[model samples]
Target: MSASRPLEGKVALVAGASSGIGAGIAEALAAAGADVALVARREAELTKVDAAVSAHGVRTLAYVADLADENVPQRAVDAAEAALGPVDILVNNAALARTGPIHDTAPRHWAQAFRLNLDVPFLLSRAVLPGMRERGYGWVVNISSEGSLLQAEWSAPYSITKRALNALTAQIDLENRHLGVRAVGICPGWVRTDLAQSPASLGVPEDELLSPADIADVVLWVVTRPSTVSVGPIIPVRPVSKSAQTVANWELYLREMRSYDTSGGHLIDLYGETR
Candidate 1:
């Protein structure tokens, strides 16, 4: 453990770590000196993220599993504990969204969204509580969306589940803050994840949207806060845009895109690198 790293001896389990904000959080936690367990369904991408995390000189475990499955939460938590000791910080960053009016949406799609967005967090929190209670310290950071509060039209399923997730965070905090556990829900307006980079989202200035690192920084900050300063029923993070907004790096971006487009099948090797 390095003296400079506040989280030197802690262990962090990050859901959805194969890419996007999840990968960013895993790497950031490792850099802050926590052993990190990366969880996601893509083994290949998870391997890349694990390698990156290990570069920070902390232990890294890659858990490849679909958290949407009811049986996987316990299995993943058990495996992480076996490999890296008890998890001190749990980041629930995995989620799925289905868009459509409630009446038009398939029941199965709604169920899937709720399972991944809400139930998995609930199960993981339940699994980690006993250990946290015994040890007398733990942090659970739930990644939610602004839709949780906005109730966007045609996004009933995702909005409903995220709202429930925020509520769950409050309930967990109420139940466990007395036991040295801090639970909080973080809802960000728009983040520059893969889904947010679509043509439709590009019209908004990129600088106005949160980046993966932005969210990761928030996670790191939340977990490292002094215990005396209690944090959260729910926290909303809004991106503050820089004064100048322009795509001055478009040439570099296009060159990289061209390189990826021509990099043959090996381009798959770089999925987690950009984020």
Candidate 2:
């Protein structure tokens, strides 16, 4: 919105922007001077972020809508465009991760995951594609997860939906390459957010988890690249001792920590922290 900024004159719409990675991405975009529209289900949460983005000297609009609803994605896109102008950047960051064994998972749960993780991105991208093509410039960044690649033991629904979302990214990239519209998937490792604090996180320390801000920085870097260069999917992983497939073992992790400290009086946590 500010005329003198790098992203000045550009507009961005970020879904699931109430907190975590979505909020961080919205803030980063606003700091770069893009008028931002925040979409999430909770008005109260979005209002708080709205205040923060407005402080960056960019117009911020909060649109409360549930991505699970079939019609909400297009409506939210229309509202964002009306408020912030045509969306030059669309960030599909909203996702629902329901963890359970395949046999135990309900049919509704899988449907819900697909709705948020896959359908919303498809619908919203369709809503904005024509405008972006007409202008011959646009960016679509889909926030995927490492779970898409890893074997999800208890998180089958999440894994399946993310894999589908990744496929959608590739399809869009192939189809829109010549039109100046680019799409890419950003897969983040275990991020320390409200969503990550669960029984599955029992052996993991807070310091070992990646922060949403870290993932947001990666997204910002991807979009800020020269328009002439388009990157494919990116996976951002924090430094951790555990295998990508195995659940973290506290004892092993702690032993490694002590060994590093005894050897060099230095220790690195999972998120690349040195102490």
Candidate 3:
């Protein structure tokens, strides 16, 4: 591998690549010379991102599909493999931002959140694991959230599913470590995406928000590290500004976590606010 283009021959499949962090990650991988497959529901946005990645002189494939279909994960992987080869890096960045008080949320909403936020990654990982194992090298990066640790009020679905994602990351690592695949979960705090800038995040400090590039840099570093370095963990990349609030809320967040219903979910709107 060239030092300037460590991922020169790598194939990376990034879900939720229509925009924001997903787009950023794809760009970073392409800059490192990785052929990229961008997957998301927006054909237009995917095409735009595909163009940007191709500018880096690497191969690019766009698979437009809503992962909520359950069957979409395998199909997405199949398409990527056919065009770009078996995935060397898989970034499970697709997520549903379901927000609502756990006690009053509906069961179907919960099901939807779990299906997208948790199940899709599990399905995608399953579809790609065999090839990665045979090749004896792969990275599965789960883009969890800082909310997973906070479990804040009125955000039950989002928080719990992400926490479960972190657990899934550990479970995947435990099972696949010996097979030469690594699973790393990243919990980013207040990324400066459109969602973070929405009215819902009113009191949030803009300057403290980490850029998608910040998260992408960390992911790139994680995947390129020597295999012997051991980097498969649920890492929390919180903004320093929010750390104190998280610490203060931890006790309350946990104490009341189990006292309410866990089946209701209110989905995030276009701007990422629960409506």
Largest lDDT belongs to which candidate?
Answer: 3
Better of 1 and 2 by lDDT: 1
Per-candidate RMSD vs. true structure?
A: 10.1, 8.0, 6.6
Error of 2 at 264 (Å): 39
Clash count, candidate 1: 0
Cα TM-score per model: 0.85, 0.84, 0.86
lDDT of 3 by residue, 1-275 (tens): 69989999899999999999999999999999999999999899899999999999999999999988958999999999999999999999999887767777789999999999999999999988899989999999999987776635577687889989999899988888888899999988667787553313344456765789999999999999887777848888866675334433333333344455434533342245552
Better of 1 and 2 by TM-score: 1
Question: Model 1, range 127-206, lDDT digits (tens) per residue?
Answer: 99899989989999999976575533345577789889999999999998988898999887667777653323234555
On TM-score, the leading prediction is: 3
How are the candidates ranked when ordered by lDDT, highest leading? 3, 1, 2
List the candidates ranked by TM-score, beginning with the highest: 3, 1, 2
Backbone clashes in model 2, listed as residue pairs: none
Q: Per the 3 Å backbone cut-off, how many clashing residue pairs does candidate 2 have? A: 0
* Backbone Cα, N, C clashes tallied per candidate: 0, 0, 1
